[model samples]
Target: MTNHIVERASARLNESTLLEMFWGMLLSRRLDERAWALHRQGKIHFHISGMGHEAAQVGTAFALNRGVDYIHPYYRDLALSLAVGITPTDFMMSLFGRKDEYSSGGRQMPSHFSSKDKHIISGSSPVATQVPQAAGLAFAIQYRQKCGLVDPNDTSQPRLALACLGEGSTSQGEWHEGMNWAGVHKLPFICLVQNNIYAISVPLESQMAVANVADRATAYGVAGVVVDGNDVLAVYDVMVQAVQRAYSGGGATLVEAKTYRPVPHSSDDDDRSYRSREEVAEWKKKDPIMRFQNSLLEDGILNDSLLHDYESRARAEVDKAQADAEAAPLPDAEEVFGSVYAPLEEQP
Candidate 1:
């Protein structure tokens, strides 16, 4: 019932953890930036950005055991994927639809993360569809432990599944159904909602009548909490609490992270039509990466010189990944229908 991670008064914000989290956020930003450029240049077809969700993504990643925990990440999980061992090269391959893309062998869309070796589950494009699937996975984990399939004394016996979705997905029936099931069964599940105040062109006010999505958690008989998605340490602290609760048979928790979407919905969308320049500028001022960098600088954990080097290194990694992806060939013609369907036969 008691755990040190949650009991600690201060967040476990060691210098090393701070550094790792920073690198994840920085690398994700650089990757997203380059991807947007590629889309503009016609090198890539589609692109979705994770500009303002970096802190929350990376913070959540560090809270879970990457290889042990199962993660059902939505499209904008660049930082979470990178933090949990999904390399930038993997993302670049998927983005380019190259043959070497491990996630879906160039089949799935970019930012649809899935790594079997890393325990990252594949997700669908339909919003909130991953919710029920993740609940099922968590139920399996919880069932295995309860039925003695897993040794009770094992350190990683109680593995959990963490699924993330945009706040707009909360409007879907599947999201509520999955949450209800996890709550009733006391399944080891963590539902993360990144509240960016908009769903494509639709604003939050039009999407949901409730002021906060976390308020709905009370209806499920599950623990609910909200955190500043822009603040990496705050998000990390809250996620650790969620992890501890999951480990202790405390069941599901809904973490509604209030963040912003700095860029347009995707490469295809334009913010100029729906949102004002002033609103975008105000949110940009609260950029998660910039805020974290300033915090590190203030704490003496990062100086201007070190920051320059760190940032350059992260960019360099992204550049190499892009180059590698550029050189990699696209999926072969034979592979076009390779995994699409099993019942169909190919025409010669």
Candidate 2:
């Protein structure tokens, strides 16, 4: 059933692109597994698993303008960051809180990824904050267009803001406020709700009344869509349309990706308490990485030998990253206040 759908979609993307997607998903899964192991071994203070969300993250990332489009991603977007050029070493440095860690200079928690070079906005601990911030960025992009800073008429250059959040964050007032503003102003914003069934220990039914999170977009008069988040190709297709609409001045879009959280909410939580083993096992049957790999093999894009080689290479890369990060020094206490503010004279 799944193979047929993936096969049809595989034809749309070139073999190299599809292979890249597979590699990202594979690397993310292996990295996530290592993080979990590191947490258990007391090597890391905390860990957030992005085990089941790779397809949606990587797929959406591939659909965007790599160096141009801005992305405001939540913590569990490891695959998304990788697809956007955040290396395994960068993640490891952040995981170990090394002084040279690119994200926050080792100040913030791991997974709060930010890179100016990659067009990724710094994320915060507070949930749903990025929603309004995304709207503001979209507005800024439009402002730049009006000021002739960017050519809006250039169809080739489509600058958009992608705001990603968990479905649980939709309950926050900021989500609604952001959506309302984007809708009214017709901002080039794409709200991606990674609905991973469970918001920590709480299930989707406990938090929202609606069956689909995308339905909330109707209130703001924006295009809302629900896609199989596990299906990488499906996500890519949807994002392509959403990006096109935003670029052409249509309006904002809310994409609800229906996926599952296979691991615990974080390293601190226990999933066995809230969910049954059977349920988790059932979801594993529909594992995104395995599904994609199967399609690739069936389509002759990949083989067993190549799959084995890819896995080995990914693991070795992660191994080197961990070693390098472990050998690096911690952040200096005296420089704690460095990035807090600019000179008073330079302040606005």
lDDT scores for all predictions?
0.88, 0.90
- Number of the top-ranking candidate, with lDDT as the measure: 2
Evaluate candidate 2 by giving its C-alpha RMSD to the native, one decimal: 3.1
Weakest ten-residue segment in model 2 by summed lDDT: 1-10
Superposed by TM-score, candidate 2 places the C-alpha of residue 278 at a distance from the truth, in angstroms, of 0.7
Extract clashing residue pairs from model 1: none
Which runs in model 1 stand beyond 4 Å of their true positions? Answer: 1-10, 156-158, 340-348
Across residues 61-123, which tens digit of lDDT does each residue of candidate 2 receive? 988898578899999999999999998889999999999699889988999999988889999
